[model samples]
Target: MRPDPQETAPAKKQRRYWHRTDWLSLFSGLLFIGIGVRYLVEPPPNTGVMVLTLVFGLGFAGFFAVVSRAFRKR
Candidate 1:
């Protein structure tokens, strides 16, 4: 069957707002990694500095990964 020319507009994909969030996530992750490394190397005594750094590093890295995936095309 022949389709009508007037009804044949190509579908347009919706744009996402992931670019800004992606960069923010990446930067935050790197910062966390740096802080984590620093804390791990010279952690404060009687405090959970090392544990906190590790948690921040892991969480930020995971968030960055998800954001990067979302904005892969950008």
Candidate 2:
């Protein structure tokens, strides 16, 4: 059967600069990075801040890397 001329093709899903699901990922990533930076800028009140800095810094970096990979253009 031939397709109806009146019916148009379904729209293709285009990836935007920021996708809905990625919103939290992106926000968390930035938040962690900010926290990490704060740790670095402020003097270490205790040894825990050092660890916090490392974890958050690395976590955000990895998160951004993964997001970037997923969003890479073909």
> What would the per-residue lDDT of candidate 1 be over residues 1-74, giving only the tens digit for each residue?
99987689776788886534555566666776776676688755445765676677677777767777777757
Worst 10 residues of 1 by lDDT: 17-26
Worst 10 residues of 2 by lDDT: 18-27
Each candidate structure's TM-score, on Cα atoms with residue i matched to residue i, is: 0.38, 0.38
Estimate every model's Cα lDDT from 0 to 1: 0.68, 0.68
Predicted candidate 2 versus true structure: per-residue lDDT over 34-60, tens digit per residue = 767877898746768657865776677
Question: What TM-score number comes out for model 1?
Answer: 0.38
Off by over 4 Å in 2: 1-45
Give the TM-score (vs. native) of candidate 2. Answer: 0.38
